[model samples]
Target: MRIIKNLLSACCLILVMNSCVKSINDDLSFVDAASAPDKLSVMFDITQDNTGLVTITPNGEGAVLYDVYYGDATTTPVSLTAGMKTTHVYAEGLYNVKVVGHAVNGKKTELIQKLTVSFRAPENLVVTWAIDAVNNFKVNLSATALYETAFKVFWGDVPNEPGQPFLEGQNVNHVYASVGAYTLRVVAYSGGAATTTYTTTVNIVDPVLIPITFESATVNYAFTNFGGATATKIPNPQINGINTSANVGRMVKNGPEVWAGALLTVGGNIDFSANKVFRMKVFSPRVGARVLLKVENLTNGGIFFEKEVTSTVANAWEDMAFDFRNINTGNTYSKVVIICDLGTTGDGSANFTWLFDDIRLTNQMPVGFLTLPVTFDMANVNYEVTDFGGTVSVPATDPTNGANNVKMTTKTGGAQTWAGSTIGAGFTSPIAFTATRTQMSIRVYSPAAGLRVRLKVEDRTNNARSVETEAMTQAANTWETLVFDFATPSNGTASMNLAWTYDMASVFFDFGNNGTGSVFYWDDVTFLTTNVIPNYLTLPLDFQSTTYPYPFVNFGGATATVVNNPNPSGINTSTKVGRIVKGAPEVWAGSFIDLVNPINFTVLRTFKVKVHSPRVGAKLLLKVENTTNPGQFFEKEVTTTVANAWEELTFDYSTIPFGFYSRVVLIFDLGTAGDGTANFTYYFDDISLN
Candidate 1:
């Protein structure tokens, strides 16, 4: 009875296990094969009078193989895998194409498509160029070909770019900013994929000089005529003992609208660093004629400056100066514009004619404040805010030790931790980073005290020479002069050279502060001239202060700085640490420290540096070189122990030959080129020897 009860319980457990268990082969096992091919598309790919090529594709489900039957020549059909394509030459007639998809279960579904192979290549393709009516620099394209549906034009300015297309025989226009040589290519395409190409070199000679003196009769300096005014060259007449030139420009204004003028352009960018004054020789038809002189960026006409000057001489030539000292020097100006008789219309008579010559820039200033020190006292002060999030910097007159000051208002963009305002000023010449003076001071007036203000100096041409320092505003709404010292080099950064570094000064107000609508005022931006402080040279070389002179002589495009230690280790419990980033493609991107006193290797033979690396077994090299002699150096390589962890790497100098080694070199991943990423950054601290 006991054995029978045990057998019944075992049978019940087996039944339950059979119902709950599943097999791995259940997903692969299927009952039915998939359906046939659908959504098939075909287009003729013909060139040179129908070579008889067609591109066909199909969208299908579960099709592994297809048999295509071309009902033209042969009885045997061609087989293709699902992604494979085939082209066949055919005669000029209708041919039927039958496509059959084969399933995994040997099931087949058939579909038929018709093709008419009638194609002709584009012939007699021609392209012409002309100037646009509205804008002179605009180039208009006219392409034509037989049996062509569209065209592609290659302007040849942008590299590795495909041509832009337009309908065949349709006029297309492209505008060029400056005058130069460009190879223009045009492709005339047939209704299919057949195309014919034509190329021509276009010499864009938009002749118009800044000082438009019509002395030569070679090329008609095509001055853009506007407002019913015709500008041309004429022989200067000795009318009333005035106008003493061989040839002069004449603007004959017709009896239409007022403000008739002629425009000219320069070949290159105008340098405005020296002076902003403009001078011109004008022979007006009458006195008090309002002559307007304007200069604009050749690329963007919107960025411009204009001034109206009244002529004092009537029917005679006199020199006039237009003060443009307030124009922004940083913006490029290459287009020169002029207008005579500003308010009234012209009648094509002698009273309407205006003659001008010798439009040039001069080194003269108006009666006002200069540009140095940037006191914001000048009426033409220039200031613009580069947004960390979004901001606007305006001139404020609520005096806090100045006639006018800069007011910064914050704006929110989405959600950002740090929203700040950066306004910069350009110097006429580069600010030299001298040995004695490498600091700049600024007076700030903030709403609240202790707001962080960062000041960055850089070469406007190259941002790589940029270096920055920050200071906290001490008082609210009170002028406090704060100095930012940049003399102390950190990490492995190359020293700032007076030869090429730091020309422009940019200031950020309330840096790293959260986004809010707070307003701040700043004024009295100046570069300080003070006595230099000597570097405290010691063996330990701790990165404790901003004034600590780093011994790196070369950085090789790598950025380095001192920050809080990411990984603290033995003998490096200090808060400050040195970080070096390999930010260039060169494998030799490294730093070499130049010690004030050479290391005596006979006394101390081993050196150690605490390094926190991204991975284990990374190659880190420490080398010592003679300060006077390069290429004569000793180097040692070591592999890191743990990943993302700090370890001490001891470089043995005992095996090295005896020499006065003052400069120390470091290279991470010495043989591999760094792609300038965050992963290439390395942190180190406590470089000491025993």
Candidate 2:
């Protein structure tokens, strides 16, 4: 009875297990059928010929080998070397190449790849020549043909015949006994039987002497002595008078002739159709003079036009130009003459002497037609705040509440605020503006005491990143005009930004502390651009004030100093130092100095140091290390002299392989002993790169 009960329980457990297996099979049946197949991967690299070799790898459990077809009807056995690459040279065409992978379990997979093949023709051939007058004349040939090919050259005095065949990429050097004319023919044959030929002419002539002259005949002036034909006249005389004794031209007695006949030209063929102008150089005169330049058409023998010019003492030896466009040439005459005179004897004293040189006929017009001075009027200063949609706020009343002329007001609190006004949200309120410049000027004004105003000037593009700012404090109510230089930022976008913030403590005005006070005004601003060259950095003697890390030691004769700072850090105070005497030691760590850009490294080709010590082992070391990763450094040692006088120590680091380094350290290591003074001192300046 017990065995029969156990058999009944086992049958019940088996039935439950079978029911669970059937439920799993039903759930798997819901999966997509397309996703249940084995995957085959095919990969290949494309070559210049447009065809590529492919490799196939199959991955599927419980699978067998079968036949494989590569989409082009080419079939092979499934057994292929693993990881082996094969080549397939297919004709030029686009194809959807596929590899069919099959298993003995009847399961199959296929991989498709889009393949393309292209065929290109050879490129054009090139020929170069090197003519040798003394020996053989060599002609170098090169071609862009991809395959092995033959070439032929036809050589003769006549260019239209075929000659002999030569191999491509060969240099043909032939000698000619005499100078004559020759023609060269080059032909190339490719693998496809396509051919191309090019021809050129070469001429060999005897060398001749070519004379180049630096003459000034292009201008209208011939020499004519004021004293007589025998008087020695300077080429361009500033003041002309008869020296009689020395035969030299001089400005004596009356004023000299500012317009000498030597500075005038006549009887020249002028072609107006080619667009020509008059150009001459003149020397400064002692007395100012008005000279008239008259142009006469020799064909018509009539004065066509005249131009009057005033010469001041400042008119030195500089080029003067006059255009013929506005001049009436009287129907484009073939011959023209120019005359210079003292303009009908008005204040014609002999103190005026003008020299002239370099007369040229040019087609260019004179530049700088007018010199207009830019001026600013402060009375018309106005501004408005407008949104992108062109909506403008009300004309902000001047002296609003207690503040005079709300130059700049902001609603945002904290950094952006206006005193005595209810602060609003968002960027808005009183805008600042500068008057347009007709001439350059500077405007200055004294503001209220304890009041600070921020002034900002930006370029025209409204690119605020380039805006320059200055803070002005009010000390008095006086107005002063300060000259402002506008040469550096000459892009002409110069606009103004004014903002004022007052502390809530006390209201201070001109001599009084009141709620309402007098307003501060500015006027007469001057703008000018000067051409002033800055002084180069020189070595200074105060070594302790330098920012560089130093234990700086001097062996008796050596001396050191700091210089000025330069833009781009060229030779400046921070860079230049002086060292005196021999055997003086100075060392700087590479980590403390700023490494210049990689491009600047090429400019700094060599390291130079000055040494006065006469020691044999005086040396300077320029060491550069990679800061990104430590332990990588390059050091160059320069040897110095032990002479009593100052001597330069140089190290040629032209071959130093430096790329993308972060740190550069320089050290001056003195030898253990030296002459003159064991304590040496040296002067060093211009730590320059290029």
Candidate 3:
């Protein structure tokens, strides 16, 4: 009894402890009833078509709740329930079906299933021959597929063997060594399953031989310096054996006379019944000269057919053919004579040098052929602002180069302006426009003689100034068109302005410049849609002096430092050192430090640089000094920037400057700014000359 009472007590204690532990655990891991759900099951039906409709059914016990993922976007959560089918029109592709179920005890389980929605195989595979050559050929295969299915092609010469098939719309090139009949097959496949096969046969034949003939009889010709002298037969002159040798007549260049001559017998007793039209090969120097082939019917002694052919370039042989079916054969004589005649001589210059070969008669009918014609299109028209003293004239004229050409100008000094000044009399307006195209083009014409014009185009959308200019020369009273292609900016807006100017004074006709007979004309400016952009700029050296206080430094080892002052005063001030260079080592040396990665800036069509020089007529040096290779420097002489005041120096960067140059430069030799004095200073700022 005592043992039983003790066991019961122990059991009660264990039971109470177990109950307490269960209560504590349940309280700690309790989940909200609304937040967590019980057993979840998902059953869905999906069509193998493009309409990705999925009907799902969820079945479970306690508080059954479910979350579903159609495998499209996880960010957007989708709640699913039992017996609720959702139709999702998704693109045809493989998708993962995800279902999540949770219990009130904070326990959850996820089940993922893969579903494939595929497109049906395309019906009616069509195959066509793109290129049909004698031995080699190409075929284009095409077919339609179900909206959801991706397709591929299988092709081979055999009907059903394992062969290479390309994707739909692929061109397949096939070559056969020997000419024979071959079968071409195409099979369409969806997913990994073959859907249908298309087969066809192509018959290839050997090259055919055709006979050629001439219409003239035996002829003789003299020699000359012009072209080689050779005799040719005229209308309906049948030469024997065209297929065996591919040649029928004899051609000679060396002769006794200064000019070559030929004679043919038109008398009877010749059978000309085996031939139709005439054909011959002539060899002559291609110095833009002309040669003639003449034929006379034997029925009549008069010449009835003749043809002239021109030669291009030099030292080339060309084939000449003529038809005599339309010739008027007079009654009586039944024979014909032929002659090869070189055109009239130029003042009896020298011996005619001409060679003739391969004269044959053929009965084949001529075939017709066609060629593609060249075509052009235009788009994107815009206007540029011109600063003509706020004048709204028919065409505003630019005063700097003063050819009275119209240009768009901004109130800001040194701002870009556009004008049609190089072209004859045009209108100007301040209407700016942007092009949807990636590229822009324009055509201009010059109407004056001995005058050349330049067209300038400026991009308004780019914060960095960029311009493109093209120069064209024109004959007197002749209209010529010029084209400018500007790369589209990344912003997708391509805005531009056009202008014309006559910068060269040596040319006779200056449209905008001061000249009595100089006039230029322009028209047909246009922009086109393209995907090409300007090649990225390449900077040899970029002097982004982040490490040093001063970006550029100048210190000549032994050269005189006439001026030594480092204060940004907007101009080269006196007290900076000046070096007098004479014979050897003729350079005022300077150094610049680069502190950052190279930055590429475009060379605008037109930009000006300001330089302060001390001396006149002395060469100043502007060089792209590379820190890596100090010896490699691009130097340009500063010719006309020598003035006490700041002188605006302009440079045209259409052509690259000479010398090995980096993006950063060390400038020296201020001879043109001021005389080499003890306190000579050169100031440079607003380096717009790109």
Candidate 4:
């Protein structure tokens, strides 16, 4: 009976197990038709403190678990249940976070959403800008900031300009249309919505070019130094003479290598077509210091040309010239290298330091003699005016008119009564003072009226042969032309002698009075017969006057005077011809004879003159203008067919109306300013109307 009961219990247990299995199978069948996860998404909670901390919380319907991808370069994905979040630290950037949702039916659902791991606002944002060394109009911009990923720049050159995006330490370039001051704005952005902005005023200008005056505030004079040499732009230590500028370039050559120096980018390839010489004002510590100026290709130092000059004046400023006439013009040069005392090493002392300014290139080489019409405006002319007795003279701008350049002469206190300045070292030629042309005029701006100014001309070879004259200033602080008549000698001075070769001139301001710190400005040193039209000149001007002043007004680097005929044969043979030397470094060099009375053009419309030229095919322009109105002018050009011989040139004025012209102008070789040579000398005489 016990065996039978156990068997029945086992059978009941088996039946109950079969019923449980059938219920499980029915549940599994229902799960097979269930859908995958729906509406899968993620939410990011970023930290506010620039820490780039993000809390990723994923959500989905019918999803039991999720695989969260941080979107960055993470090797493994994070697994999280529903309603659970994971913390991640990311750099400030944009990211597309991915979520893989797993449902109860073993189905997977994946979705990608943009994730932004933004931090707080950027802090301590710094922006820097620099002018491009090669292109003056171009600027390089960069920025740095804490907790910043990228930057946007507003160049402020256009209206409604869009921002340019760049990363940190990346150089953003901008080109300006012109030179001016512009507002530059840079925005530093964190990965989040926070941003930091910095604004600054940037000055745009032309890059440092041929004439590197070291005066531009916008130029990046960041010289590239090598071999332990240091170079910088500094305030001028000694400002006097021709260079009165405020800034200069200083070079300290206390380096280990003898060839230590600095190089500067001169913006572009140096134009060697026009100028071939480089000039600079240098203040050296001692005499005989060699200064080497070299030009090289912008990238290759091996392709270079150099010139060296030695300083003559110790502890004083002097203009030095470096000749680069043999430079290879075919090669391009964009850098200037300066090495002082090139063969010796510096000790970082005053002896090793040099100050320089007014670096420029020119075609005018020093001729060693300052010539007539000293305007002080010519490049590389070397108006080396010497001062004595505590008088200082320098090139200065006109006080009344800023555009007009003049010379400033200062007589400091405790100066000699005869404190004066020489006009220059000496003139290339002597002052030819004829019987009638014995006067010289100077435009003077005095500190006070009634100041006596003395003009003296002497033979440079012999100082004893000098004539001095005095003229009183009639205006104060205004420019007035004062005539000094050497014919009437100053008191206690020798009279003018026509036989002496007066090749040097000197000027004394506030004559006969001890300097009380008086200052004077003077310009336009002119030599003339007279400014007063004492008598009207008529036609048939033979220019043979020993008593009557021809009064030929010269202009544009011309020196015209009446003298003995140089070539007195062939077609004309006469003394006291009009000589014109067009060698004063100008192109439109000529002279005009201003007549007080108009020429008789009604009777004769044709004019003739005898001319002597140095070259054939030389252009001679003869023009006539209204006596008072220079604008009303008529001109005719003639060419010379005979070289170094006398010839008659005819000018017909048939179209020129009567009573309209009183000035007769003459120009030889009207376009070329020749070097000081005999080839530029010309002569003419026997002007008559037919």
Candidate 5:
């Protein structure tokens, strides 16, 4: 019993000590649920200058962090730790700044501070502006001054346009809508109430056209670039030789495509009918740089034509010509695309750059003016004639030759005595007439022989400066060339004056007689290079004398002319030769020259002629005929052995007896008609008896 009481006393002592330790570890701090962060405020430190810079510092009694909200719509609230400050730029306005402070226990306090941001008047404000170099419609503006915070622009192109805001040292661009001058206004604002406004004038213009010299202030010269090609109108860097304009077009290539180019809308279709050759003055960095000029339809890129040419000189201005004689005129091409250094990628270096000016259209020949030798066979010529005194002239098929085209003229019964038809709407240029060239010829088919055909020439601008001459038609209903000598004018008409500029010509059929429903066909109006009287043709015919008129009577689509030898080597190096172009009309097309007298065939029966043919195995016929009777003729045919070179062809007439034959007739490829191409052209010289 005594031992049990002792154990109980020991356990009771351990329990009392454990209870005392638990009482020492219990919480005794006070708790309040309504307590939160307090004393939240913000300080706004505004700079004294007009620049609306405001520095805000938020503070609170129990705050650990702060959120500052700028009243401007441009920015959101920013979070900052305690004792940190934030700066904000604002225009001159009254704004309410909000501040929120947060405690360590996540309870927040909010405050709204009414801050009045005012600024002084901006001083010495200057606005700098200029037109964009490549784009004339765009204007770039900038400003600099003291106490300026922001800038707003009034482009002056629209009514009630809200100003666009921009900061200092920043350039702003405004593109005008049209091509004219307009007022530009720029306003500079600061932190204070005052502001500075400046105004200037801006001008925009239209795009340039062909013959692009790039010197006009009103021309836009806007080039649309593709594949990294860039172009600008700039002052001429190297102006000499063919191009001396004040400004030029500069092209730089930095593209991956081989055909990178600059295209420009020309606003209208390029008339390729009269002027088929294009010319430009170019200053290339290197020689042999291929430059391509192309034209495309206004909206369709698939309809395009291009021509390429290489520069022959480097670092100097050179004139280049591109022949587009065969371009299709049916398509409408309005855009001009230029590519420099074609077929190669550019590196944006000076070596790949090109300067060009004076983009224009020239003529390979005088295609714009209608001069002599009007055949009515050219594809692009207008050939439109003007009729007077109730006369009408129209293009028609040749009555005798089907392959030839001529003009058919009709005079009504009630027509005037001077009824006539004019050749083209008064020639664009003056007719070439010299002292030795005072005669003109026309092939005419009249209703009756011995009809007086009058040919007159005058200055279209002045009717008093004119000369008229008359020639009689010899054959009726058959083609015959009549020579009109202007040196001997008609009895009452003016004489030929070489000093005047005669640009128009007209022909009158059955002159001095009132029209009685007469119809005539005429063609081949040629201005004779020499007088009407020619030297009579004879044997041993060599076309070397400039004074002798080698008039070969062409018939059945055969044309013969005395020209310089195209290829003057190989057996014949003579300066002059005869060229014959056979066209499509008859299979037996040929030419005959009337000799002054008959040939003496007593000893020499073989005839030899040096001929140059385009192909081998071409049949050449040489025949001798009576001057008046073509039935009494003897002929022999020979074949050529060589091509594009001179060779001697021989014909024997030993079987023919002596006769009065005074005409020499020659025919090439008698059975096959020709198409008047180079392949069907023949050249011959040195005709003699061997």
Candidate 6:
């Protein structure tokens, strides 16, 4: 009786403590009451009729109703009550049908089912195909027939197979993505009553419409005379070797016409999606003759992209390149207009006659220092920011090298001294560093010159292995390409090696300088070599490399970045360190690193890291998991003994079961939730096995 009474009293005390803690927080009441639905299922069966009628049945517990969607011509969803069947007609083809179940508690679940329907051939079909004169290879289709309830088209392009179906009198348009021969087919149906199939051939080839090498058979290339300028296809009239082509476009600009030029209307729109740069041969009347090439849409002549270039050589054929990278691919352009000496009228003399040939389009960037090893910002490669005091954005304003530039704005009240950013910690590809190519070049636009620019490189995971260099500009207020030799820093330290795989890179506009709220522009970061040292557990990991994602897999919204060591001491004394900001809503926000080989437990049983926390007595947990079996894990926790200082914590794993441990995990304040604030932030360096 006494034991039972004591147990009841203990339970009451626990309940009172829980009640007090709960009363302190009320924000969590909606966490569980409103959640997304899960485990929804949808089953469907189509009728054998060529008419795409589909009967859909949705199944899910706790769901009040179902939203059925037939991924076809239909845009609206079919709302179905619980336990009721819904039907949707889909033509004879494959479809990705979706069912979203709505639960009573404001939750939802979804499932997608691939539905295939193959019916007997449709009937009473009338199929017709016409190529779009505006968009090359884009065909306009028409299908009409008596007793036809639906129509289907197999455009014969591999991607448009067993194709989509539509109703009669509907105009179906399809754009062929590539150049090739295609067999266009159509099927008509009478709503599962009868069906018929029709087929035809379509030839799609790249436009040979440009360069007016009239050598080929006489094809009407409508090079019409405009602005009193006339151009005609003729045999090479010049006796010079430059006129090697059998035929060329000869143009004569008559006087009194300042915009005297010729216009060639293309049968299809000029595609500038992939290739934007254009090159054309021009046999000019003289050097410095201004030649402007412009393209405008057939209907919307206002939507156009044009470039003007001067003839470099006199009385000789030369290739003039025009940059049209700013054009939008969504617009159509079919008319090509050329203007000679755009400003001054030309005389109908021998000097006004010119011949040209071999015009083409390409997407290559100009050859220069930027494109040599690697074109910075090429293909829009992502550069992840580790730290930023204010905001960073990519704007296409004034690029020194390519089509874009990166702008960095320093916050007014942000960190003054070392408020910097780093990118590519876990860089997938490492740039190779050689003796001759040990320098990195960058184009910068600073608010003022003479400000020190710092460049740093490190192993994304180790701080002890780092190199930094700084350069001050002699001129400011203008664009300048600065070459940084990776040999010394402002601290008078030299750490450069040809064999080092220095991948992570960071750039600072002003080293150790306070903020003046400045905006900076930089582009074209050129490097010859680049992270991570695998195996050899004896090697301590010091997060020094500027290349990043940092060599760690972070989870639970934890943030980790390599920065200047806040506290470097003991055997892990290094200039760089790993800073971790524990996230909220999770008691265990942490990260893990995968080693190349399994840890030799018998030889090295102690896991060590020099951790610096903001507060003492914070719980820090270190864990190891079997490489092959993540569930097979071992963990140890230690409390921080010192605050705002570095202390080495050694975890003894000698008693752990023998296993291939290849992953190491770290968690700060293991059981206590974090707000991702300054108080929950921590730093660690020299993660090694003892």
lDDT of each: 0.68, 0.38, 0.39, 0.82, 0.80, 0.69
Whole-structure CA lDDT of model 6: 0.69
TM-scores for all predictions: 0.29, 0.21, 0.24, 0.32, 0.32, 0.38
lDDT tens readout by residue for model 2, 168-280: 56566555445566777767655333466677876544321111011322221233333211111343333232111211222221224433332222333355553445665
Question: Candidate 2: lDDT of 49?
Answer: 30
lDDT of 1 by residue, 159-182 (tens): 985988898657888887666778
lDDT of 4: 0.82
**Model 2: how far is 111 from its true place, Å?**
99
> What's the CA error at residue 193 for candidate 5, in Å?
29
Q: For model 6, how does the per-residue alpha-carbon lDDT over 108-165 read when each residue is reduced to its tens digit? A: 7888888887665544576777878767768998888765677888889886377878
What is the overall TM-score of model 2 with all chains considered together?
0.21
- Which residue ranges in model 6 land beyond 4 Å of their true spot? 1-212, 238-243, 299-301, 365-395, 398-690
Top model by TM-score, which number? 6
Per-residue lDDT of model 3, residues 4-69, tens digit only: 343345445545676876454334222333344445556667665435566655555532335567
Candidate 1 versus truth, CA RMSD in Å, comes to 25.6
Of the candidates numbered 3 and 5, which has the greater lDDT value? 5
Query: Given candidate 3, what's the lDDT at residue 141?
Result: 42
> Residue by residue across 1-690, what tens digits does model 4's lDDT show?
332343345445545676876454334454568689899988888877777788999999977678888889996888786789999998878898999887655567999999866567889998888888778789998899988878999999998978999998788899998889899999998877788999988888667787999998777798999887899999988888777899999999886999999989987799998677899999999999999999999888899999999998888899998878668999999999999999899988999999998889975445357777777677646664677887867668889888887889899898899999888778889887987788788888888866778899999999999988777666677787777767556544676789889989899998888998999999888788553422124467787644346778998889888888887788878877998888767899899996533554544778888899898998889898876777888888888889899999998878885445668899999889955578988889888778
- C-alpha displacement of 634 in model 2, angstroms? 57
- Per candidate, the number of residue pairs that clash is 0, 65, 105, 1, 5, 33
Rank candidates by lDDT, best first. 4, 5, 6, 1, 3, 2
